[model samples]
Target: MLPTKMTEALNNQFNNELQAAHAYKAMATYFSDKGYQGFANFYLVQSKEEDFHAMKFYHFLVTMGEKPVIQGLLEPKSVFENALDVVKQSLEQEKEVTRDIYSLVTLAEELKEHSTKAFLDWFIKEQIEEEDAFRTIIVKLSGIQEGGEYFLKMDEDFSQRTME
Candidate 1:
């Protein structure tokens, strides 16, 4: 069973994951509207993955005898200057998510919630991959001076990255 505070925290994380999914879906729409279908599909897949992550937390909370409460999500930014700018924003968001996960781990440790810490370990590892993946995209985008065939090739490359 989970402590009340831990349960609340888990629910908050679950909601945040859903918000992340919503945000990614918005980004996907933006990309699609801008004629970057590959990038849009990439974010669509990311949205699905975020939903899965949220569900994982939801299931964990259920197992702990807590009801999950999803909250309102903020609208995602849709006016990216270009594809590279969108990728830059994504990388920054991923870094922020990594920090949030670390903070949650620290909070669990401070609360002596060992199970929460253990549960968060998966997210911690996931955040590492998430950041690394975006970092690679940022690196690739950094080399392209303009959005043209290079950007298209970059999109193709980024599309190849499966969300495993």
Candidate 2:
């Protein structure tokens, strides 16, 4: 059995994940418009990942006998000066997400909801990987001139991480 408060929080978190997916889709469009196809593909993949995360929460809520509510997502910015800026903003957004996840975990602990904590453990590890990956990319971007061969090569490398 799940606590009522925890269930409501999970629904909100699910919607937030969906909103993050929307934000990544907007960023992908911005990259594509700037001719960074590789980065655009990266964000497209990110959007998909976010969608999966939302679904994960939704499934969990269903398993807990809670109704998953859909909330309205706000529009995200579609313009950035360059790939670095886009990814930097993404890293910051991800950090914010990590904070939210941590808060949920803490709440679960306070409420003696061990199941919620166990599920959130996966997200805690995943966030660590996400933040480190972007931090490394941001550092690499620091050395490369924007729109140059280096940028193109980096984009290609990033694109290789995507499915198909």
Candidate 3:
């Protein structure tokens, strides 16, 4: 069985993952409206991935003999000044998620929840990859000026991303 504190934190993390999915869907909508189909596709995949992450937590909670709580999600931002702005916002969100994940790990450690700690190890690595992916895109976008051929090419590249 899971400790109450750990269970509560996991529930919050599950909700945060759902919020991330919502935010990514909003970002996808923004890109679609701007005619950046590739960027939109990428964000759509990201949103799906976030949903998967949330479900993973839900399943983990259940497997540990704990009930998972569902919570309401806030409205995600639908507008962005530019594609770069969207990428920047994504990076910021990833950073926030990293912090949240770290907090969960810390709490699990404090309680000596070995199984929970092992499970969170995957998320810790995932957070690193998530941050790196967004940061890499931010760097590439920063190098390309607005409305440039390279920027459009990058958009095309992003669209090619498929769920792995």
Q: All candidates' lDDT scores?
A: 0.83, 0.89, 0.94
Q: Which candidate number maximizes TM-score?
A: 3
The Cα error of candidate 2 at residue 99, in Å, is: 0.5
lDDT of 3 at 136: 92
The top-ranked prediction according to lDDT is 3
TM-score, every prediction: 0.91, 0.96, 0.97
Ranked candidates (TM-score, high to low):
3, 2, 1
lDDT of 3 at 4: 96
Model 3 error, position 71 (Å): 0.3
Error of 2 at 126 (Å): 0.5
The local distance difference test score of model 1 is 0.83
Q: Return the candidate ranking by lDDT, descending.
A: 3, 2, 1
Candidate 1 per-residue C-alpha lDDT over 85-121 given as tens digits, one digit per residue, 9 for 90 to 100? 7778888887877887888888889899888889989
Model 1: CA > 4 A from native: 159-163
The clash count of every prediction, one per candidate, is 0, 0, 0
Model 3 Cα lDDT, one tens digit per residue, 1-164: 89999999999999999999999999999989988899999999999999999999999999999999999999999989998899999999999999999999999999999999999999999999999999999899889886689988988898899988
